[model samples]
Target: AQSVAQPEDQVNVAEGNPLTVKCTYSVSGNPYLFWYVQYPNRGLQFLLKYITGDNLVKGSYGFEAEFNKSQTSFHLKKPSALVSDSALYFCAVRDKNAGNYQLIWGAGTKLIIKP
Candidate 1:
């Protein structure tokens, strides 16, 4: 089975500073990692994903993630975050049991960006 986990319940970062949200995975083979951000009263918004290719991938809203095979980590990052960037973030990976490679999301981590 494939799975993903967000180890932190919340992450705090000051505006303009870099921020990272941690994610770890447990999978049999090459894992597909996806990151999403959810604003209050809004659905999730796709950020970026690591399917295959370069280890560092850039995505929407100036967000990016680095895939580390040895560490089994795909952490989301941004060089500088804004106050509006504060939201609930989720990490997901492919579900092996599903025929169509549906994603199973981990618990969300609240991001707090202080001005």
Candidate 2:
């Protein structure tokens, strides 16, 4: 069984400041982690993924995340935030144990950027 956790229901940040959205996971073996963002009334847009390779991965819209094996964390980050960046972010994990390819998703984190 695999699972994802996004502790914060919302994150508040001032425009131009750095923002971070935390995520953690639990899986039997190595996990395939992903990040997605959803606007007001749109579908989940693929942000980035950690299939393998370097721990730090860069994704769409200046977003990046660091994969920590020991801590089992993949926290999303952006050096500079923008008002347009406000949206609902999600962290998901593909459980290899499951016969079907279904993503175990986190509850969600609503990011609010203040100008």
Q: Candidate 1 on 20-115: residue-level lDDT in tens?
A: 999998887778889999999999999998989999999999999999999999999999999999999999987444557778788999999999
Worst 10-residue lDDT window for candidate 2 reads 93-102
Question: Which sections of candidate 1 miss by over 4 Å?
Answer: 95-99
**Residue 90: error of model 2 in Å?**
0.5
Q: Estimate the TM-score for candidate 1.
A: 0.93
Evaluate all candidate structures by whole-model CA lDDT and list the values in order: 0.92, 0.96
Q: Pick the candidate with the highest lDDT.
A: 2
Q: Candidate 2 on 1-95: residue-level lDDT in tens? A: 68999999999999999999999999987789999999999999999999899999999999999999999999999999999999999999986
Q: Residue 41, candidate 2: how far off, in angstroms?
A: 0.9
Give me the displacement of residue 6 in model 2, in angstroms: 0.2
Q: Report each candidate's C-alpha RMSD, comma-separated, in the order given.
A: 1.5, 0.9
Q: How high is each candidate's TM-score? A: 0.93, 0.96
For every model in order, what is the number of clashing pairs?
0, 0
For candidate 2, the per-residue lDDT at 36 reads 99
